[model samples]
Target: MTTHPAPTVHDVRHEETGEGQPTTGLDAFAVCALSGAYSAVAEARRFTAAILEGWGVCAPVVSDAVLVVSELTGNALRHAAPRGPDAAESRPDLVCAAWLALAHQEAGVLCAVSDSSRAVPALAAPDLMAEEGRGLWIIDRLSESWGWTRPDHTGKTVWAQLPVPRPTR
Candidate 1:
Protein backbone atom coordinates (compact mmCIF):
# COMPACT_ATOMS: atom_id res chain seq x y z
CA MET A 1 0.00 0.00 0.00
CA THR A 2 1.20 3.53 -0.75
CA THR A 3 2.12 5.45 2.36
CA HIS A 4 0.47 8.77 3.13
CA PRO A 5 1.13 11.35 5.79
CA ALA A 6 -0.54 10.77 9.13
CA PRO A 7 -3.66 12.81 9.84
CA THR A 8 -3.08 16.18 11.49
CA VAL A 9 -5.68 18.46 13.06
CA HIS A 10 -5.39 22.22 12.56
CA ASP A 11 -7.34 24.80 14.52
CA VAL A 12 -7.96 28.10 12.74
CA ARG A 13 -8.39 30.33 15.75
CA HIS A 14 -5.04 31.97 16.55
CA GLU A 15 -5.59 34.24 19.53
CA GLU A 16 -5.48 32.39 22.82
CA THR A 17 -7.31 33.83 25.79
CA GLY A 18 -8.30 32.20 29.09
CA GLU A 19 -8.23 28.41 29.16
CA GLY A 20 -7.24 28.09 25.48
CA GLN A 21 -10.33 30.02 24.40
CA PRO A 22 -9.92 32.29 21.42
CA THR A 23 -10.44 35.92 22.28
CA THR A 24 -11.67 36.69 18.79
CA GLY A 25 -15.30 35.88 18.21
CA LEU A 26 -14.42 34.15 14.98
CA ASP A 27 -15.97 30.76 14.60
CA ALA A 28 -13.61 27.92 15.51
CA PHE A 29 -12.59 25.67 12.65
CA ALA A 30 -10.56 22.47 12.55
CA VAL A 31 -9.71 20.05 9.75
CA CYS A 32 -7.91 16.74 9.35
CA ALA A 33 -6.50 15.13 6.25
CA LEU A 34 -7.48 11.48 5.99
CA SER A 35 -6.12 8.69 3.90
CA GLY A 36 -8.37 6.30 2.01
CA ALA A 37 -7.70 3.57 4.54
CA TYR A 38 -10.55 2.34 6.69
CA SER A 39 -8.65 3.43 9.80
CA ALA A 40 -9.48 7.01 8.87
CA VAL A 41 -12.99 6.54 10.20
CA ALA A 42 -11.80 5.93 13.74
CA GLU A 43 -9.12 8.58 13.42
CA ALA A 44 -11.77 11.11 12.47
CA ARG A 45 -13.88 10.17 15.48
CA ARG A 46 -10.99 10.69 17.91
CA PHE A 47 -9.97 13.96 16.27
CA THR A 48 -13.52 15.31 16.45
CA ALA A 49 -13.97 14.33 20.07
CA ALA A 50 -10.74 16.04 21.08
CA ILE A 51 -11.58 19.22 19.22
CA LEU A 52 -15.11 19.42 20.62
CA GLU A 53 -13.84 18.76 24.12
CA GLY A 54 -11.25 21.51 23.77
CA TRP A 55 -14.02 23.87 22.69
CA GLY A 56 -15.91 23.02 25.93
CA VAL A 57 -18.86 21.42 24.11
CA CYS A 58 -21.11 19.31 26.25
CA ALA A 59 -20.50 15.57 26.40
CA PRO A 60 -23.74 14.69 24.64
CA VAL A 61 -23.07 17.03 21.75
CA VAL A 62 -19.50 15.78 21.52
CA SER A 63 -20.67 12.19 21.32
CA ASP A 64 -23.21 12.97 18.61
CA ALA A 65 -20.66 14.94 16.61
CA VAL A 66 -18.14 12.11 16.86
CA LEU A 67 -20.65 9.64 15.54
CA VAL A 68 -21.51 11.96 12.68
CA VAL A 69 -17.85 12.29 11.83
CA SER A 70 -17.42 8.53 11.80
CA GLU A 71 -20.32 8.04 9.41
CA LEU A 72 -19.21 10.77 7.02
CA THR A 73 -15.57 9.70 6.98
CA GLY A 74 -16.44 6.03 6.51
CA ASN A 75 -18.77 6.82 3.62
CA ALA A 76 -16.12 8.93 1.97
CA LEU A 77 -13.50 6.22 2.33
CA ARG A 78 -15.77 3.58 0.90
CA HIS A 79 -17.45 5.47 -1.94
CA ALA A 80 -15.07 8.20 -3.04
CA ALA A 81 -11.78 8.43 -4.91
CA PRO A 82 -8.91 10.84 -4.49
CA ARG A 83 -8.91 14.03 -6.56
CA GLY A 84 -6.86 13.77 -9.72
CA PRO A 85 -4.09 16.14 -10.54
CA ASP A 86 -2.91 17.37 -13.96
CA ALA A 87 -1.65 13.90 -14.77
CA ALA A 88 -3.54 10.83 -13.70
CA GLU A 89 -1.40 8.44 -11.68
CA SER A 90 -2.81 4.94 -11.79
CA ARG A 91 -1.06 2.49 -9.53
CA PRO A 92 -2.34 -0.61 -7.79
CA ASP A 93 -0.74 0.35 -4.49
CA LEU A 94 -1.65 4.02 -4.49
CA VAL A 95 -3.67 5.35 -1.60
CA CYS A 96 -6.40 7.98 -1.97
CA ALA A 97 -7.33 10.68 0.55
CA ALA A 98 -10.20 12.74 1.95
CA TRP A 99 -10.68 15.67 4.33
CA LEU A 100 -12.75 16.09 7.48
CA ALA A 101 -13.61 19.57 8.72
CA LEU A 102 -15.36 20.73 11.87
CA ALA A 103 -16.62 24.24 12.36
CA HIS A 104 -18.53 25.86 15.20
CA GLN A 105 -21.84 27.30 14.05
CA GLU A 106 -24.20 29.66 15.84
CA ALA A 107 -25.83 26.86 17.81
CA GLY A 108 -24.17 23.67 16.68
CA VAL A 109 -21.13 22.01 15.18
CA LEU A 110 -20.81 21.46 11.43
CA CYS A 111 -19.14 18.18 10.48
CA ALA A 112 -18.12 17.88 6.85
CA VAL A 113 -16.11 15.38 4.85
CA SER A 114 -14.85 16.14 1.38
CA ASP A 115 -14.10 13.42 -1.14
CA SER A 116 -13.53 13.21 -4.86
CA SER A 117 -16.78 11.46 -5.67
CA ARG A 118 -19.63 13.60 -6.93
CA ALA A 119 -22.32 11.03 -6.18
CA VAL A 120 -24.83 12.58 -3.81
CA PRO A 121 -25.75 10.77 -0.63
CA ALA A 122 -29.34 9.69 -0.24
CA LEU A 123 -31.27 8.87 2.91
CA ALA A 124 -32.59 5.40 2.26
CA ALA A 125 -35.84 4.11 3.63
CA PRO A 126 -35.43 2.01 6.74
CA ASP A 127 -34.69 -1.63 6.09
CA LEU A 128 -34.77 -3.38 9.42
CA MET A 129 -33.87 -6.73 7.93
CA ALA A 130 -30.83 -5.45 6.13
CA GLU A 131 -27.48 -5.42 7.85
CA GLU A 132 -25.97 -2.47 5.96
CA GLY A 133 -26.90 0.95 4.50
CA ARG A 134 -27.80 2.69 7.73
CA GLY A 135 -25.22 5.44 7.85
CA LEU A 136 -27.35 8.25 6.50
CA TRP A 137 -30.34 7.04 8.48
CA ILE A 138 -28.36 7.22 11.71
CA ILE A 139 -27.07 10.67 10.80
CA ASP A 140 -30.61 11.91 10.12
CA ARG A 141 -31.72 10.62 13.47
CA LEU A 142 -28.84 12.19 15.38
CA SER A 143 -28.21 15.50 13.63
CA GLU A 144 -30.38 18.60 13.26
CA SER A 145 -29.71 18.75 9.49
CA TRP A 146 -27.50 17.12 6.90
CA GLY A 147 -26.67 17.76 3.22
CA TRP A 148 -23.95 17.98 0.60
CA THR A 149 -22.23 20.79 -1.29
CA ARG A 150 -19.88 20.91 -4.24
CA PRO A 151 -17.62 23.93 -3.89
CA ASP A 152 -15.79 23.12 -7.14
CA HIS A 153 -15.20 20.36 -9.68
CA THR A 154 -12.68 18.56 -7.52
CA GLY A 155 -15.06 17.06 -4.99
CA LYS A 156 -18.13 17.41 -2.80
CA THR A 157 -18.50 17.95 0.93
CA VAL A 158 -21.10 15.92 2.78
CA TRP A 159 -22.01 17.72 5.98
CA ALA A 160 -24.17 17.42 9.07
CA GLN A 161 -25.02 19.93 11.78
CA LEU A 162 -25.47 18.64 15.34
CA PRO A 163 -27.08 21.03 17.80
CA VAL A 164 -24.96 21.84 20.86
CA PRO A 165 -26.91 22.82 23.95
CA ARG A 166 -25.42 25.74 25.82
CA PRO A 167 -24.33 25.14 29.38
CA THR A 168 -26.32 26.81 32.17
CA ARG A 169 -24.14 29.33 33.96
Candidate 2:
Protein backbone atom coordinates (compact mmCIF):
# COMPACT_ATOMS: atom_id res chain seq x y z
CA MET A 1 0.00 0.00 0.00
CA THR A 2 1.15 3.53 -0.72
CA THR A 3 0.17 6.75 1.06
CA HIS A 4 0.30 10.16 -0.45
CA PRO A 5 2.39 12.75 1.33
CA ALA A 6 0.37 15.38 3.15
CA PRO A 7 -0.12 18.64 1.33
CA THR A 8 2.66 21.17 1.88
CA VAL A 9 2.53 24.93 2.41
CA HIS A 10 5.02 27.15 0.63
CA ASP A 11 4.39 30.86 -0.10
CA VAL A 12 6.77 31.42 -2.98
CA ARG A 13 4.83 34.17 -4.77
CA HIS A 14 2.52 32.09 -6.91
CA GLU A 15 0.48 35.29 -7.48
CA GLU A 16 1.04 39.03 -7.59
CA THR A 17 -0.77 41.90 -5.92
CA GLY A 18 -0.66 44.34 -8.80
CA GLU A 19 -1.04 48.08 -8.13
CA GLY A 20 0.68 47.71 -4.77
CA GLN A 21 -2.18 45.74 -3.27
CA PRO A 22 -1.35 42.36 -1.78
CA THR A 23 -4.90 41.20 -1.28
CA THR A 24 -4.93 38.74 -4.17
CA GLY A 25 -1.36 38.14 -5.22
CA LEU A 26 1.78 36.51 -3.94
CA ASP A 27 4.51 38.56 -5.62
CA ALA A 28 6.48 38.20 -2.47
CA PHE A 29 9.95 39.66 -2.20
CA ALA A 30 10.87 36.98 0.32
CA VAL A 31 9.37 33.61 1.13
CA CYS A 32 10.34 30.71 3.35
CA ALA A 33 8.99 27.51 4.85
CA LEU A 34 8.73 27.78 8.62
CA SER A 35 8.59 24.99 11.12
CA GLY A 36 5.11 24.48 12.54
CA ALA A 37 6.09 25.67 15.97
CA TYR A 38 5.34 28.79 18.00
CA SER A 39 9.01 29.77 17.99
CA ALA A 40 8.87 30.24 14.26
CA VAL A 41 6.50 33.19 14.66
CA ALA A 42 9.27 35.31 16.13
CA GLU A 43 11.54 34.37 13.27
CA ALA A 44 8.78 35.24 10.83
CA ARG A 45 8.44 38.67 12.41
CA ARG A 46 12.18 39.23 12.22
CA PHE A 47 12.27 38.10 8.61
CA THR A 48 9.49 40.53 7.72
CA ALA A 49 11.11 43.38 9.58
CA ALA A 50 14.40 42.85 7.79
CA ILE A 51 12.79 42.59 4.38
CA LEU A 52 10.63 45.66 4.91
CA GLU A 53 13.56 47.63 6.19
CA GLY A 54 15.62 46.67 3.18
CA TRP A 55 12.78 47.92 1.01
CA GLY A 56 12.92 51.32 2.75
CA VAL A 57 9.49 50.93 4.28
CA CYS A 58 8.44 53.36 6.97
CA ALA A 59 9.15 52.28 10.52
CA PRO A 60 5.53 52.41 11.61
CA VAL A 61 4.36 50.21 8.77
CA VAL A 62 7.17 47.78 9.40
CA SER A 63 6.18 47.57 13.03
CA ASP A 64 2.63 46.76 12.08
CA ALA A 65 3.83 44.12 9.67
CA VAL A 66 5.85 42.47 12.40
CA LEU A 67 2.87 42.36 14.73
CA VAL A 68 0.57 41.15 11.99
CA VAL A 69 2.96 38.38 11.03
CA SER A 70 3.25 37.35 14.65
CA GLU A 71 -0.47 37.00 15.06
CA LEU A 72 -0.94 35.09 11.82
CA THR A 73 1.95 32.75 12.52
CA GLY A 74 0.86 32.24 16.10
CA ASN A 75 -2.62 31.27 14.96
CA ALA A 76 -1.14 28.83 12.53
CA LEU A 77 0.98 27.28 15.24
CA ARG A 78 -1.98 26.67 17.54
CA HIS A 79 -4.78 25.92 15.11
CA ALA A 80 -3.36 24.70 11.80
CA ALA A 81 -2.31 21.04 11.72
CA PRO A 82 -2.22 18.01 9.46
CA ARG A 83 -5.49 16.08 8.97
CA GLY A 84 -6.22 14.03 12.07
CA PRO A 85 -8.30 13.75 15.24
CA ASP A 86 -8.15 16.85 17.43
CA ALA A 87 -6.44 14.81 20.13
CA ALA A 88 -4.17 12.04 18.86
CA GLU A 89 -3.80 12.59 15.16
CA SER A 90 -0.63 14.23 13.89
CA ARG A 91 -2.03 16.79 11.49
CA PRO A 92 0.65 17.36 8.87
CA ASP A 93 -2.17 18.60 6.66
CA LEU A 94 -3.16 21.22 9.13
CA VAL A 95 0.25 22.84 9.59
CA CYS A 96 3.23 20.55 9.34
CA ALA A 97 5.20 23.41 7.86
CA ALA A 98 3.80 26.90 7.26
CA TRP A 99 4.99 29.32 4.64
CA LEU A 100 5.75 33.00 5.29
CA ALA A 101 6.01 35.72 2.70
CA LEU A 102 6.66 39.46 2.48
CA ALA A 103 5.88 41.76 -0.39
CA HIS A 104 6.40 45.44 -1.06
CA GLN A 105 3.69 47.28 -2.97
CA GLU A 106 2.63 50.82 -3.81
CA ALA A 107 0.50 50.87 -0.72
CA GLY A 108 2.72 49.45 2.03
CA VAL A 109 3.85 45.96 2.97
CA LEU A 110 2.00 42.68 2.73
CA CYS A 111 2.61 39.91 5.22
CA ALA A 112 1.26 36.48 4.36
CA VAL A 113 1.21 33.05 5.98
CA SER A 114 0.11 29.88 4.27
CA ASP A 115 -0.85 26.66 5.99
CA SER A 116 -1.97 23.23 4.78
CA SER A 117 -5.50 23.72 6.06
CA ARG A 118 -8.11 24.97 3.61
CA ALA A 119 -10.31 26.34 6.38
CA VAL A 120 -9.90 30.08 6.55
CA PRO A 121 -9.52 31.90 9.78
CA ALA A 122 -12.71 33.57 10.94
CA LEU A 123 -13.16 36.69 13.05
CA ALA A 124 -15.41 36.53 16.05
CA ALA A 125 -16.26 38.67 19.03
CA PRO A 126 -13.44 38.60 21.52
CA ASP A 127 -14.03 36.81 24.75
CA LEU A 128 -12.48 39.10 27.32
CA MET A 129 -11.89 36.18 29.60
CA ALA A 130 -10.56 33.76 27.06
CA GLU A 131 -6.84 33.36 26.54
CA GLU A 132 -7.01 32.53 22.84
CA GLY A 133 -9.00 33.15 19.60
CA ARG A 134 -7.98 36.76 19.17
CA GLY A 135 -5.33 36.41 16.49
CA LEU A 136 -7.45 37.38 13.50
CA TRP A 137 -9.11 40.11 15.50
CA ILE A 138 -5.78 41.78 16.15
CA ILE A 139 -4.79 41.37 12.53
CA ASP A 140 -8.01 43.05 11.40
CA ARG A 141 -7.64 45.91 13.87
CA LEU A 142 -4.06 46.72 12.84
CA SER A 143 -4.19 46.02 9.13
CA GLU A 144 -5.84 48.18 6.49
CA SER A 145 -7.41 45.06 4.94
CA TRP A 146 -6.98 41.36 5.61
CA GLY A 147 -8.31 38.20 3.94
CA TRP A 148 -7.50 34.66 2.85
CA THR A 149 -7.41 32.78 -0.44
CA ARG A 150 -7.47 29.09 -1.40
CA PRO A 151 -5.33 28.64 -4.45
CA ASP A 152 -5.24 25.76 -6.92
CA HIS A 153 -5.40 22.33 -5.26
CA THR A 154 -3.38 23.25 -2.18
CA GLY A 155 -3.88 25.25 0.99
CA LYS A 156 -5.01 28.79 1.77
CA THR A 157 -2.97 31.93 2.33
CA VAL A 158 -3.93 34.54 4.88
CA TRP A 159 -2.64 38.02 4.18
CA ALA A 160 -2.77 41.53 5.65
CA GLN A 161 -2.13 44.82 3.85
CA LEU A 162 -0.79 47.74 5.85
CA PRO A 163 -0.92 51.16 4.24
CA VAL A 164 1.85 53.57 5.10
CA PRO A 165 0.97 57.04 6.24
CA ARG A 166 1.76 59.67 3.65
CA PRO A 167 4.09 62.49 4.54
CA THR A 168 2.61 66.00 4.49
CA ARG A 169 4.05 68.63 2.22
Candidate 3:
Protein backbone atom coordinates (compact mmCIF):
# COMPACT_ATOMS: atom_id res chain seq x y z
CA MET A 1 0.00 0.00 0.00
CA THR A 2 1.21 3.46 -0.81
CA THR A 3 0.55 6.53 1.27
CA HIS A 4 0.21 9.84 -0.52
CA PRO A 5 1.79 12.92 0.92
CA ALA A 6 -0.64 15.57 2.03
CA PRO A 7 -1.14 18.58 -0.21
CA THR A 8 0.57 21.84 0.67
CA VAL A 9 -0.66 25.38 0.04
CA HIS A 10 1.15 27.98 -2.08
CA ASP A 11 0.81 30.47 -4.96
CA VAL A 12 -0.55 33.55 -3.21
CA ARG A 13 -2.24 36.31 -5.22
CA HIS A 14 -2.84 40.05 -4.85
CA GLU A 15 -5.53 42.41 -6.10
CA GLU A 16 -6.18 46.12 -6.08
CA THR A 17 -9.25 47.56 -4.44
CA GLY A 18 -12.11 48.91 -6.54
CA GLU A 19 -13.69 52.32 -6.25
CA GLY A 20 -16.64 52.73 -3.90
CA GLN A 21 -16.20 49.17 -2.72
CA PRO A 22 -17.19 48.30 0.81
CA THR A 23 -13.49 48.36 1.62
CA THR A 24 -12.35 51.67 0.26
CA GLY A 25 -8.81 52.94 -0.16
CA LEU A 26 -7.57 49.38 -0.10
CA ASP A 27 -4.17 49.85 -1.66
CA ALA A 28 -3.18 46.21 -1.79
CA PHE A 29 -4.50 42.75 -0.92
CA ALA A 30 -2.90 39.32 -0.61
CA VAL A 31 -3.65 35.73 0.40
CA CYS A 32 -1.06 33.16 1.42
CA ALA A 33 -0.82 29.59 2.58
CA LEU A 34 -0.93 28.91 6.29
CA SER A 35 0.54 25.41 6.05
CA GLY A 36 3.73 24.08 7.64
CA ALA A 37 5.16 25.47 10.88
CA TYR A 38 6.18 28.91 9.67
CA SER A 39 4.13 29.67 6.58
CA ALA A 40 1.82 32.14 8.32
CA VAL A 41 4.53 34.36 9.75
CA ALA A 42 6.48 34.27 6.50
CA GLU A 43 3.48 35.20 4.44
CA ALA A 44 2.48 37.94 6.87
CA ARG A 45 5.87 39.60 6.53
CA ARG A 46 5.85 39.26 2.78
CA PHE A 47 2.40 40.72 2.39
CA THR A 48 2.89 43.47 4.94
CA ALA A 49 6.10 44.60 3.32
CA ALA A 50 4.55 44.67 -0.12
CA ILE A 51 1.52 46.64 1.01
CA LEU A 52 3.52 49.08 3.09
CA GLU A 53 5.97 49.72 0.31
CA GLY A 54 3.20 50.21 -2.19
CA TRP A 55 1.56 52.74 0.11
CA GLY A 56 4.85 54.50 0.79
CA VAL A 57 4.49 54.05 4.53
CA CYS A 58 7.72 54.68 6.44
CA ALA A 59 9.95 52.00 7.88
CA PRO A 60 8.79 52.12 11.50
CA VAL A 61 5.09 51.81 10.70
CA VAL A 62 5.81 49.07 8.20
CA SER A 63 7.76 47.19 10.84
CA ASP A 64 4.93 47.44 13.34
CA ALA A 65 2.39 46.30 10.74
CA VAL A 66 4.49 43.27 9.91
CA LEU A 67 4.70 42.39 13.59
CA VAL A 68 0.93 42.60 13.87
CA VAL A 69 0.45 40.30 10.90
CA SER A 70 2.90 37.84 12.35
CA GLU A 71 0.98 37.64 15.61
CA LEU A 72 -2.43 37.27 14.00
CA THR A 73 -1.33 34.65 11.49
CA GLY A 74 0.57 32.73 14.13
CA ASN A 75 -2.51 32.59 16.29
CA ALA A 76 -4.56 31.20 13.41
CA LEU A 77 -2.06 28.44 12.69
CA ARG A 78 -1.66 27.47 16.36
CA HIS A 79 -5.35 27.36 17.16
CA ALA A 80 -7.05 26.34 13.92
CA ALA A 81 -5.22 23.17 13.02
CA PRO A 82 -7.00 20.51 11.01
CA ARG A 83 -8.03 17.15 12.42
CA GLY A 84 -5.45 14.70 10.96
CA PRO A 85 -2.09 14.71 9.27
CA ASP A 86 -3.67 14.52 5.84
CA ALA A 87 -6.17 17.09 6.99
CA ALA A 88 -3.32 19.20 8.20
CA GLU A 89 -1.65 18.96 4.85
CA SER A 90 -4.79 20.26 3.28
CA ARG A 91 -4.80 23.19 5.70
CA PRO A 92 -2.40 25.11 3.52
CA ASP A 93 -5.14 25.37 0.97
CA LEU A 94 -7.40 26.90 3.58
CA VAL A 95 -4.68 29.26 4.67
CA CYS A 96 -3.83 30.27 1.15
CA ALA A 97 -7.47 31.03 0.70
CA ALA A 98 -7.28 33.33 3.70
CA TRP A 99 -7.53 36.98 2.65
CA LEU A 100 -5.78 40.18 3.71
CA ALA A 101 -7.01 43.70 3.06
CA LEU A 102 -5.12 46.96 3.53
CA ALA A 103 -7.32 50.00 3.63
CA HIS A 104 -7.03 53.64 4.63
CA GLN A 105 -9.45 54.50 7.38
CA GLU A 106 -9.89 57.70 9.30
CA ALA A 107 -7.92 56.24 12.16
CA GLY A 108 -5.01 55.12 9.94
CA VAL A 109 -3.92 52.13 7.90
CA LEU A 110 -6.20 49.17 8.52
CA CYS A 111 -4.78 45.66 8.38
CA ALA A 112 -7.42 42.97 8.13
CA VAL A 113 -6.74 39.25 8.32
CA SER A 114 -9.57 37.05 7.20
CA ASP A 115 -9.68 33.27 7.58
CA SER A 116 -12.18 30.48 7.03
CA SER A 117 -12.16 29.57 10.69
CA ARG A 118 -15.08 30.94 12.66
CA ALA A 119 -13.11 30.97 15.91
CA VAL A 120 -12.71 34.35 17.53
CA PRO A 121 -9.46 35.32 19.19
CA ALA A 122 -9.45 36.16 22.87
CA LEU A 123 -7.02 38.19 24.97
CA ALA A 124 -6.01 35.89 27.75
CA ALA A 125 -3.86 36.86 30.70
CA PRO A 126 -0.42 35.33 30.63
CA ASP A 127 2.11 34.87 33.38
CA LEU A 128 4.70 37.61 33.23
CA MET A 129 7.38 35.01 33.09
CA ALA A 130 5.62 32.99 30.39
CA GLU A 131 7.01 32.97 26.88
CA GLU A 132 3.66 32.90 25.09
CA GLY A 133 0.03 34.17 25.15
CA ARG A 134 0.85 37.81 24.48
CA GLY A 135 0.10 38.08 20.75
CA LEU A 136 -3.30 39.73 21.06
CA TRP A 137 -2.12 41.78 23.98
CA ILE A 138 0.64 43.26 21.85
CA ILE A 139 -1.83 43.91 19.06
CA ASP A 140 -4.19 45.67 21.42
CA ARG A 141 -1.47 47.95 22.63
CA LEU A 142 -0.11 48.87 19.21
CA SER A 143 -3.35 49.31 17.33
CA GLU A 144 -5.79 52.14 17.77
CA SER A 145 -8.64 49.64 17.78
CA TRP A 146 -8.74 45.94 17.06
CA GLY A 147 -11.73 43.67 16.60
CA TRP A 148 -13.28 40.84 14.62
CA THR A 149 -16.27 40.72 12.36
CA ARG A 150 -18.31 37.84 10.97
CA PRO A 151 -20.87 38.80 8.40
CA ASP A 152 -22.52 35.37 8.51
CA HIS A 153 -20.44 33.50 11.10
CA THR A 154 -19.03 31.10 8.47
CA GLY A 155 -15.71 32.83 9.01
CA LYS A 156 -14.22 35.83 10.74
CA THR A 157 -11.83 38.63 9.96
CA VAL A 158 -9.71 40.29 12.61
CA TRP A 159 -8.49 43.82 12.00
CA ALA A 160 -6.27 46.51 13.51
CA GLN A 161 -5.71 50.08 12.48
CA LEU A 162 -2.36 51.78 12.94
CA PRO A 163 -2.29 55.54 12.99
CA VAL A 164 -0.37 57.18 10.17
CA PRO A 165 2.61 58.97 11.58
CA ARG A 166 2.85 62.69 11.08
CA PRO A 167 5.59 64.06 8.91
CA THR A 168 8.65 65.06 10.96
CA ARG A 169 9.24 68.80 10.92
Worst 10 residues of 2 by lDDT: 1-10
Q: Model 3 lDDT vs. the true structure? A: 0.67
Candidate 2: stretches off by over 4 Å: 1-28, 83-96
Q: How far off is residue 121 in model 3, in Å? A: 1.3
Query: Which residue ranges in model 3 land beyond 4 Å of their true spot?
Result: 1-37, 88-97, 151-153
RMSD of 1: 9.1
Residue clash pairs of candidate 1 = none
| Residue-wise C-alpha lDDT for candidate 2, range 1-169, written one tens digit per residue | 1111223345334454567654643334788778865678888888888888887788988888899999988877676644234523654343346888888776667778887666767789899899887778888888878887754456677888788776669
Q: lDDT of each prediction vs. the true structure?
A: 0.77, 0.73, 0.67
RMSD of each: 9.1, 8.8, 10.5
The count of residue-pair clashes in candidate 1 stands at: 0
Q: In model 2, what is the error at residue 63, expressed in angstroms? A: 1.1
Q: Tens-digit lDDT track for model 1 on 65-122? A: 9988998998898777544462136433333478889998667898988877768787
The per-residue C-alpha lDDT of model 1 at residue 39 equals 83
